[model samples]
Target: MLTQTRNVEEKLYFNRFVVDAGRPHITVRPHERPSAELRSLTHMCPAGCYSQNEAGQVEIATDGCLECGTCRIVTARTGEVEWNYPRGGFGILYKFG
Candidate 1:
């Protein structure tokens, strides 16, 4: 049987992006407590940028974000994330057609 074997991370790596290192377009609520859904971001993010720190708080690294909006939707229940599109020339840039 023939089948394709490309993962989300692999595809993200191929795509180009201009990350605003100085400014993250997304941020998890530092004041609010973490919920299951928020914690899920660690695995849900295609870029694998969201993760738990030593303190067990959800931390997001927006650099590798695919701009897929998954985090915003997943964490909608708590509204613990502040998400916004990167500047006009920033963020993910899909090169493959």
Candidate 2:
């Protein structure tokens, strides 16, 4: 049997995201800006949904989120993030295993 191999980006292309406008499932607390946990999210998130703003504050855009819960785990004890599942039918849809 011939198997196909795909890179991370390529595999990710098979996934689809349904964004919930005006109702982001994940948000960075403004009061928690510039924290070590938030900073770590910038690089730790597999979907790259977290980033550092010009003012050195962490920000989140939930559109392309893989919903892997990395952010939640990283900031769970810090109270620096708000994490939840998107509304039903709005979130990542994995096309392949």
Candidate 3:
């Protein structure tokens, strides 16, 4: 079987991208609270958008998000992650296309 040839973020770094500043499309509830279910999103998000802050709070940096919906799917059980698509013309854009 083939291994993960490259780190997820490393690969996403090569693609063209755009980030909106106003509001994040993805958000975590109970800002200071921690959840085992949501914590796993840090490893599952392909773009490495989900992570824990120094305070141990779940942080969702949507800029690099690949919009893969993996985070939404993983956190669906708890309904704590607010997931939605970015407004039109926002978020990632592939350069080659």
Candidate No. with top TM-score:
2
Off by over 4 Å in 2: none
Give the Cα-based TM-score of candidate 1 against the true structure: 0.84
What is the lDDT, from 0 to 100, of the residue 66 in candidate 1?
Answer: 85
TM-score of each: 0.84, 0.91, 0.77
Ranking by lDDT: 2, 1, 3
Tens-place lDDT per residue, model 3, 35-97, is 787888888777788888888888887877778888788877888899899889888875423
Candidates 1 and 2: which is better by lDDT? Answer: 2
lDDT of each: 0.85, 0.88, 0.79
**Model 1 lDDT, residue 75, Cα:** 87
Model 1, 1-97: lDDT tens digits are 9976777666656888798878889988885469999999899887888989888888988876788999999989889899999988999899653
Which pairs clash (backbone N, Cα, C closer than 3 Å) in model 2? none
Runs off by more than 4 Å, candidate 3 = 1-11, 95-97
Better of 2 and 3 by lDDT: 2
Flag regions of model 1 displaced more than 4 Å: 1-10
